[model samples]
Target: MQLMEVCVIAKCTYKSETIMFSVSSESSMVDILKTLCLRFRGLQLGCFTLRYSVPSYPSCFLETDSDLDLMRTFLLISNEKTVDILVKDLCGISEYSGDFCVNKELIACEKGESSCSSTVEDRNEFLGRSKRASAKPLLSNEWETYIHHVGQKFDGGAEEFRLKLCKYALEVGFNFLYAGNDKKRVVAVCSNKKLEGCSWRVYASRCEATGSFVIRTLNNVHTCAGRIRESKSKMMRSRVVSSLIVDRIRAKPELKPVEIIHEFKDYYGIDISYYHAWFGKELAKLDVHGDESKSFNELVWYTDAVKETNTGSLCTLDCEAGINRFRRFFVSFGGCIAGFQYCIPLLFIDATFLKSKYKGQLLCASGKNGNQGFYPLAFGVVDSETEENWTWFLQHLASILLPMGRVVTFFSDRNQGLLNAMGFVFPGWPHSYCYYHLKQNLISKYPKSGYGKLLQDRVINLFSRCAYAVTEEEFKVAMEELVIVGSSKVKAFISDLSRDHYANAFFKGMRYGEMANSLAESFNNWVGVFRDLPVLPLIEGIRQKLMVLNSQRRFEAEKWTTVLCPEMETRLCENAEAGRTWAVRRSNSTVFEVFADYSVMVDLEQRTCSCRLWQIDGFPCTHAVAAILAKRDSVYDYVECYYKTDFFRKAYESPIFPIPDIGKGLGSNGSAAVVCFRQLQRGQPEDHQQRGSKFLFVVVKVDGILNVGVDIGQAFNTRRF
Candidate 1:
């Protein structure tokens, strides 16, 4: 066996010493232990273990022969020249024994002269180093791990020190207050100082040399009971709470006050009031997204920024008479306006309530893309859902869509204000009423107690059948059934409504199979989370959502390989399958006779069938499908151009640019001084007056443009109330 030089290091609570030894490669654990005991002289009296001094493998204990062999193999593989072993005390009793102390010096002298080749000078050099220097405490960045001591240094001045002290006192479950506070110094003491004479105190002063605060005196011994100190702590204020929950609020802005209270109680073992949590959350929100009141003022800059970045876009702001008070605001992105040319011409108009500090109404005009997806055309915020407001919104919409020369249809519930507005703005256009809303009105008009709900359901079903009927004869049959079962009032109500608005057979414009304004409802639900924000943020949020929707749809449309959209293709395929059993007879190149349950005439040239489904739905119906298949023609050719993949791509090709941050280069030095309108006082209770006043200080820097008599129409096209 080959011999190797091994260095054995012994460590205890008081001292550490090293000695050299000559060992054979075949040495076992027992052999090494016996040699260590004989050489150290103190190991014979107490429990100890031998471990390899490999820093990477600190717990490699050599307790058996296999452990010794593993250590040797590891050392050989690691190419270590010297074999280092650590002798650790297992019982920690022998290092302090008088006998061990007397034998340590004798063993050192013997080893100094032995053939192991370790000298007394080398031993003294290792033992002369201070133990405190080797075990110095490390500084921690976490406040929970910080320990206060005299002469400790902090980077910031009195404010930073006070903040850290508050956090530290809270972490340790103790109450503290400032005994002396100023810009140059801060002195904190236990809150129980007057009652119990608690000695816990920390005094920090600004250092003249480094301009940082340094702890001049610290007496960390507290004499008060733990319960009293923890229960009476006043360190948990709104400022501290804001600092603690700022990051959480930034990640989830919808976090409620009750959730914050529960989080503090469960996580920090502290109880807080609802007001503190709410105020803290408000402060954090201000830090994250700015003040809600100021966000209203940012609207002017935001509108200008949107117009500058997105060319051909229209943004108008309306103010009350004689004062710069906000009344209504409207925005229509250029991309959405340009893209509407490729979407379905039918617009679903609706209004939803805003849930902000200053409550308002959100009027939306949404369309359907080629794939039957919701496409928002334009939206605006108004003071209320009145006829005048609706008329103003429709005027802006007309300015965008009327120039396109396309025959558009308006679909919505029969809200009186909306109906009146539609009549005033687009008098010649076709407006369809949602049959669902009409049925709801009927249900409300006739209570279930008069005749059970079953009768109501039957009446609504018969009316729905009439609305869905394909021809005048079918509608007449459905109406006869309804009249036989319905009361005289119900019959009168149904007769008063125009059949051209609800009945599919009499509708003058193509409805595209839509019977309700579900698209606007969907848009409302999509932006529901952001409704609580102020006016500017709500508008910006909608813009961001539309931007993402357009980009995502454009990317998805790029990957489509079908000639028509997937929805239209599926509809065409289903119609072809249904018509498989039907027989077709050719009349001419453009005319054919399809025989099924009832014979229908198909005109391929007009893209219509006698059943009326093909022309109304913008696709080949069952009869038309049979006739087209008989002629060996493709069904996709008869589908409307709006349902083509090329049209879908065009609908989402325009990009919606991001609006830059407000107040970038803009200042509030202009002559225009805008304020929030106090319109809620008209019909609201006294308690709502404060919420109405939240919209404040909407100052716009008109510069010299408005003063120089620029046409108000050319500048803003705004309607003054």
Candidate 2:
């Protein structure tokens, strides 16, 4: 019996009576060697005996274990020729005591005498042929070759490789680990399973993403590079500030501050995830600090940057609100109006709704002089048209105007708030209700009947007369013809007025000839340009109107001064005639001049400066200015009494408004016409729906499907779904 020697490979081993062996035909020698190294402690034996037995075949025993192991090792390590020599010397390779007779058959088969026969030369030829695995280097020593091969696999199936790459990138540590064969136009990745079914699938990673390994090849790495570059370029497109400034630049080319940013998107594509990356960096630069303490940045920039830019501003702000919106103009109880160097006594007051589309508060104001044409001087809005709103409005108004002088009188609508707010601010100041509102209210209650006409005439007459009405009784008699009872709306209105302190004072002191709030009505009519507008446009319109009005007023003032200088000189000469009428006058140490309008006489010594012109112009009117200057009084005193500090301060006092207690009004209910319809058959798909005749009655299903019928209403019947 010939016993083959066994060779042992391990890191370590313990002596034992029996020797253990493991063999595999599927793997090459190197694979087997690596597996042995992993399983055992150390290489222990050079050779060992072996015996083989199979259920169908016979058994084989090695004569000498050392010779067999040596021969096997030689077969593994040597070329074909050397293996042949070793195999020949080690004949009787499958010796079995019981199979000795059958051995002759195997020998015959080996000699090509049977179907499984093969000549020794032929066997050697088979042994010498390289196996598929043997043709390739071991994976450990051939990393580059592996990558290249895997890359080739990807090239063979590009889309499949891409899918694999995407899946792997989503998994393993290598967000992406890929190899490219630019010349072959292929890209490959190593992941969980052979990507696109390529050669390599080494998915070893510490990432917990997912343990899916795949090796995949992709076609056209160049295309990927180009796309990536395009994507990057698109990502780096326009900056934030530049983008924001683009519209501004386009709108006003002359105002362009810097480079223009054309478009944020690009040809390849846009990645929304990358927008913040680029925009954030650019926006940070917008936090610029400029020189001016009250610079535009503080106001417009701060709000625009922090709030407006991030969100968005109302589009109509400047267009509507800035250009056409009304602002409140206020004059203190005793404040004088001023224009340029002249002070005027008259104050025109009114209230209008805010133009902003947002539910804006009300806007009340003192109107500008004729020259300025109702330019608003101050402004405010409130949640409601209440006494508080009016009071707050008046107080703020008084503050703004009073510094100029005391407001001799104020004109506004008969709104309770206006009256109450004034009273709160100026306890004892004269105020006038808008004549239009008063007239409208009266006309609404009583048409042109004798009594209505008489009442209207009387109210109108009271304001037009010269002497301020002296007593409440005399004022009452003027309206004696009007109805004064539960059936009379005018009578109730009058009675209500009598109860109001401010209104009472106004009626008592009403100068029969003085025109009331006609000017305010006109001003309000002009401001109609701004009604019911969106916020941005409303604000913009108002601002623009103000700017234009102010600019025109300033221009007119300059023109009036230029044109009337010589005329005033002549007036001064005439002033010298009557007790030496001086062109200028001094009143309580302040000087004023009277200009134009030759109507009233100017008495410098008496401090009786008139032209009533001062009231109309909101300035001293050349005559008053001239008169005051004659006395060398600095021509400042007669500056409209309203402009004086005492009066000006009074304008700041709150105005008063009388709020009516809310209650149900007469006749609350009413009815109007309406229409109804229904549908009939439905569910089945049809080419088109039949149109129903105008007056035809049709049965309609609850679902709105209609069916044609002679009288659908009478024939209506419910159907189960």
Candidate 3:
């Protein structure tokens, strides 16, 4: 409620529109603008800044927390009251139409100036004289009635109510009485009177954010603080700058201290120390996310809400009542069913650090879809990436994965935790170590000198080539090259790791050809900023991204011209071109011999070539291409089902149902019978689903769910839901 400096404006105008308000000359432009933004959805608040144009000086933004009177002096334009809100950072703000600007004309008027609006010379004098306000001294019951009415009109967030209270005190000649719990409550008393124990107090009653707030008027002074003072210190405490910083962090919790310091300084011209900025950031979080420890307490409710609303979503939280009360948490959308079935069966596992107040590790299990991009299947939050933690993660993963077999493969870095965990959960299942991590580990272990630098580069290059080699012969040649110059330690490292796990040549036909954990690594980096937030916020952020990704990928799939995805199509074309030089002899309609440096028998019936490229990789190998050319086979039929656009569409067909805000009650389609099935393509609850007549139900994609409705051909079928 404190105005530090005073301004007396001559005139006001906005060249664009005629906007009217309950005028108060004493009110700061910031307060007016904020009130306007709240009322008008058309106002792009954060994008634009208030600016004042003057005759002698060029037009500039109003950067300080200054009052209207002080700002008017700098205005050289005829209409000193008018301020332009110059908008910047225009991206995605408008989707359906072009960029639009609203022009507002603020006319300067002297007739309605509040008595509190004072000039520099008489500012303190006016405020000092009018510091206290008079209220019709009322009984306790009447005061309570008045408080209730005030709360009804301005009932919202505590901060918003705080602003309203400041305005009310200024209007009614009262001041903050000050009382118990200064952190949460604002108590206002008669400013006209001296600080006393029996002053009538108007208390802001903050309730659970979803509900309305009530202002309570108390007669008794069970708890009271000294009367409020009008000074720089008082102004600093109740100023909009702190609240603005808090709002910024609430919008983007990932903002760091440096960013906070810079933002505060740049906008307000007030230099805050790193610690002050940090304190502001923390305070902001407290307002936005509530208590850090309490967020953990809400995990159970949050997960239940998620599962109840999202249906097939997997949200599991495990806690142990030991020294470390919090243990592990894992969550995944039911859309994973589609991803696992229609996308490549390769899962990339990786762990990233959580930079929130409670430090931990984020373990992710992601798959590569037709577009060769990260298709996040599941995520786990653990105390650390230990064998036991990973085992817990993998064990839970096994639950949602459904009828797991050796057909599904996993890629991970050579972490002992993953090795041990995968060995237990997947036992005989094929596990591939990331080639990139292996090379990085090898390089780190064998630090080389000036001349050895070249050797180091060569060793890394050889290892990479070995992993990517087209055939066993090519891999063998690279191994021989490494042996001639490789160190004993490097050689031992290479020998210890299974070739089938890292080397493309050693891997048999059941291969997805994913030699690295790039899917998970890239996904981790994609959500790098979100990971810097609290557990719930991070998960919420990822969920939002997944929703967008599901829609976007499906949209992109709709535009594809070929049967296979763009990348697969491009790869097959390249192989087909290369196969032109190779000579092929037809043994039968479905069999052919491709003669190159070595003879590769291509069996069209089995869709496998002797070179194994056609089998390991979903795309047609050069040998397969040669046979297809000789046998006149359909190029479309050779590519794996996972590479097709239809499969890609199916991979992202189901929506990840949105979970409602924590206190907004259940979602629109939330139910109690509970969802034990995958998410539907539309937003409708299972209980609400109406059974239809004898419709053919065929499953083009096998997600282990027997959805027995919808017309289709040549796939698994069912009769009813």
Find the candidate with the highest TM-score and give its number: 1
Residue 591 CA displacement from its true place in model 2, Å: 20
- In Å, residue 165's CA in model 3 sits off its true spot by 12
lDDT tens digits, residue span 1-721, model 1: 9565543322211112356565556565556666777777556322454555553454456566776667767766776655546565433222233232323333344335444567677566434322222432222112432334455567766656777787667655678878999988888888889899888888899998888787899776677776332522478778777877889887777789999988876656677788889998887877766655456556767778989988879888776766455678899999998899999998999988776556678889999999999999898988677778899999999999889988788899887778899999999788989877887887776558656577878888898899999899999999999888787867788777899998998998989888877777888899887776667778988999899989999999999999989988888888889989988999999899999899999999988899888877877888998998999998777888899999999999888998765547444434554433334523455456455445332323354232211123224332231
RMSD of 1: 14.1
How do the residues 235-344 of candidate 2 rate in per-residue lDDT, one tens digit apiece? 22234233333444334322312222222232112222344433432332232211111121122222232223212111111111422212222121111123311322
Instruction: Give all candidates' CA lDDT scores.
Output: 0.73, 0.36, 0.62
Quote each prediction's TM-score: 0.69, 0.33, 0.62
From the highest TM-score down, the ranking of the candidates is 1, 3, 2
Q: Runs in model 3 with CA error above 4 Å?
A: 1-242, 321-324, 404-406, 595-601, 665-721
Which segments of candidate 1 are over 4 A away from where they belong?
1-166, 177-189, 199-221, 227-235, 443-451, 476-497, 661-663, 666-721
Every model's Cα RMSD, please? 14.1, 30.6, 18.1
Model 3 error, position 600 (Å) = 4.8
Cα lDDT for residue 535, model 1? 79
